[model samples]
Target: MALEKYSTVLKMAQEGRYCVPAFNTYNYETIAWAIEVAEEEKRPVIVQLYPGYDFYIPLKVMCDAAKELAAHASVPVCVHLDHSATYEIAFAGLAAGFPSVMIDGSSLSFDENVALTAAVSRAAHALGCEVEAELGHVGSGSNLDDFATGGKFTDPDEAVKFIELTNVDALAVSIGNAHGAYAATPNLQLDLLSKINDAVDIPLVLHGGSDIPDEQIKQAITRGIAKVNIATEYFRAMYKGYSASIAAAPDKDSLFEISQMSKDSVKEFLRGKFNLLKADV
Candidate 1:
């Protein structure tokens, strides 16, 4: 099938008590490997391209690669634009063939975030793209000690209002989850996540899935988190594969062998993650 709607897979995860693994991709190899493993596991996966890296990689190329790969995949594959900071970028993603786009207005004030999200939601919904909006700031993983730097924890009551006004399909809450690799194990505020879960009807998303203990992730899914974003670790896994391939290569210029090994690495990492979520999917 072609790219599935983000909500279709996420709502399934919410109902089945598992979180959809959203892997951020920057190139064709990454996109191909994501679908390759999802098909092998017979599970759903989200292929996300971060707009923040558009300076280095074109969004259109990423979108084309994912769409081509997902069209023939046996399992559900969602092509998404991850954390589009500006309305223009979200629209750009939509134009590039993203079935889902996330508008990151968490850095703005509540009202400001609402307005920005509402605008993007209106346009995106009309075009049949699911929108994921963030409330409260998900801070950088390196500076976990400073709440001020990462923004405040998402207010449960406010989360309800944000959903109603924006009319988004998913809400990403900041309950101590941050982006990139964590310096240490995170003590996720599952208690706060429960409150947000009770207050909202849409699927909840947890960013920074990398390095979080599996026990906490399972606990969060049991609570209400339906979508979990994993990036840093996946990139690390891909690099690990590339490094190994180079070390075992008979010649230094064996680009084909190195590339194939890198994909093997991606499939290996995904197999473990799929098994973790298999009980539900």
Candidate 2:
């Protein structure tokens, strides 16, 4: 399968009944796993890399690796940059041939966020890349401290205006979803999600999806969410694989074992998630 752009996958999600799983990839291991699952399931998927995540590594390696893996697959695999805080990182991802990039200015004021997102949108769009901007600060932490972010919520009215002015390809709203794994059960604000979906024309994204229950996620998708970002669970799987590799053999076993293990774990995870996403060729 060819690597499609984010817009193409998102449009399918919107018209279809479920969302597309956007898995975060930090290295070649996770990327391989994502592509494997996407191919097996024959579903469109988005593989994203966060800012400062293995920043020392070149982006081309990641892109080329994914491109190679995607070449013979049976599904669409789109690469993206997730939670980029600066124009430099965003531009790098675009120049490196990522199909999509997200500028997460949710930490800034409304006006500032709009300004930055607009600039990023222009830059990315000019390069034939899709841009995603976050509105309302989805707290930085996944625990009780998430509440301390002042419960940053996206007002439907503001979301409408922001999308119009920014012209972003997608909108990630902070409807009670935070980053990282939740220490407790998260109470997703479905009402806010409904209002935002009703107001915005583009696809809505749900972050911190790893911790949310199946029912909450299913309801959110039914209400009009097209993208779901997952990270912590995959991270946990990668760590567990490494630990198991060490415990099983103290010798200098090939690191590829750990990499392959992580990939398999994440593949299983994506299979389940895309099932919920109702992935179909």
lDDT of 2 at 260: 55
lDDT of 1 by residue, 17-78 (tens): 66688998888788888888888777789989999888888888888878888888888899
RMSD of each: 2.0, 2.5
**Which residue pairs in model 2 clash with each other?**
1-73
Q: Poorest 10 consecutive residues of model 2 by lDDT?
A: 141-150
- The runs of at least 3 residues in candidate 2 whose Cα sits more than 4 Å from the true structure, single-residue gaps closed, are 143-150, 248-252, 258-264, 279-281
User: Candidate 2's error at 174, in angstroms?
Assistant: 0.4
Give one digit per residue, the lDDT tens place, for model 2 in 1-281. Answer: 57888988888888877799998887777887778887787778888887676456677677777777767668887888888897888888888777788998998999999999999999989878899999988775445656333368888999999998899999998877888867667878888889998888899988888878788898899888889999988788678867876676668578866555445555676688888775233
User: What is the overall TM-score of model 2 with all chains considered together?
Assistant: 0.91
Q: Please report, in order, the local distance difference test score of every candidate based on alpha carbons.
A: 0.85, 0.81
